[model samples]
Target: MDSQSRVFAAILTESGREYTGNENPQRLKVQAVDRQILNNRVQEVQVTGTAEDCCPADRVSVRVSVGHSKDSVNEVTNSVSRRLEYILQVVRQHGASEKDTSVRRFLHREADKYHMDAEVLITFSDFEKMERVRSVLLEKLAKSVCVGTPQFYHSAECLSLMRRRACVSAVENAQQKACEVSQLLGQTLGHPFLVREEETREWKNEDEEDGGRCQNATRLPHPSQIPTITVSSQVSVSFTFRDISKKKPQ
Candidate 1:
């Protein structure tokens, strides 16, 4: 057997996007950008799980964005606060399960003379039932906050939890493929001589402002879904091949 070996590397990826909107140009632009990023980075795979049509059954977390003139921060805050309260009242009226609904994060910033942004995150267990809540909020903002639709995202913690399983599966798949290739090379595969697994997360535009100066504001599709975590594995495998000269005499 000689100490020479040939290795090959392969990768697999998966992704998803969830959103709902009319034919608004702005919305379409956002959707297109989101699709482009995902298509370029992700591979098609059968992901089991209903597209998160509504928030999860457990408490769903939501982010609300509000903006106003810098000089009007106080006014904007007051108005937005009142509007939120009204929204809460409406949710209560609609039988929202308040036990799971609460404020999660808040941010306020001054961008310019005519730009002040405030953001609030609300968490609730029953997101599917929030249609009334959204309607009430829109109605409240009609006369006050000059903001667009409040974007919703599955919490980071939730995503990490969900992806962990997928990551494991991807790792196993990579190993199997590596072994298959080793077998096809006419050699007995040995322990991995070297293995490298890498994952890269890219967003459309993480530097965009979100109601305020968001460090990385990615305008993902309605589901605020990220392209599947691309788990790439590079393995340098060593295998033993019998030397023809050393073959046993029949």
Candidate 2:
């Protein structure tokens, strides 16, 4: 073949096609240029951002128990019943609903006397009300009633809200950084092209580096003072860039 035909054949082979002088030989070059232009059309900036949010424990559970041993089963039942009724009443009076309170009993005979023990598990939403209930039970029943320490924790809804807030804050921080970078590059910031949560972590605030246990404390920590749950989120975001010179000023 001629020199021109040979060159065309070589280009066709490189493009993974059979040489066809009848067709446009420059088609492959045109397609390559188009691809380069398309690749340069949208420039992107990738940045990582991190943020944390903390929420105090929103629920507390307390357990109260009473037990009595008497000569007969009826005597034991009546004695335990009185204390149980009183405990339930105090809990209800403090705004706790029946659904939030659960009761369990154990009855048995040892040697000759019969024994009965009852427990009331209460979940409280209001710390002050729980304190009042605890105080009344202790003052009225005294040592007869055993009130367990309150356990504080975050509710499911509270945790869900905290996680969302942390993730959104992280994304916002990433966008802010991307905007600054684009400005430095003399480009306008466009809409985000990609967003991904790279990592997430949750732990008690007490585990923080700056936090430490208080030794020789005078009083126990209050319900509200309980260690809060801290959630942190790290996100990777890619934002498109627009030419500042081509943008119309608002």
Whose lDDT is greatest here? 2
- Which lDDT tens digits does candidate 2 get at residues 1-250? 0000011111223454544457765564423334344344546677788888888888878788889999999999999998899899888888999999999999999999999988888998888887788778878888897777766778899999999999888888888777777777556788887889888899996632322221222233664568799898888888776545444768
Report, for every candidate in turn, its global Cα lDDT versus the true structure: 0.41, 0.74
Question: For residues 31-65, could you state the per-residue lDDT of candidate 1 as single tens digits?
Answer: 22344453354221111111111122233344555
Model 1 — TM-score against the truth?
0.39
Give the local distance difference test score of model 1: 0.41
Relative to the unseen true structure, what is the C-alpha lDDT of residue 35 in candidate 2, on a scale of 0 to 100? Answer: 37
Clashes of each: 6, 0
**lDDT of model 2, residue 111:** 98
TM-scores of the candidates are 0.39, 0.76
lDDT of 1 at 104: 34
Q: State residue 142's C-alpha deviation in candidate 2, in Å.
A: 0.6
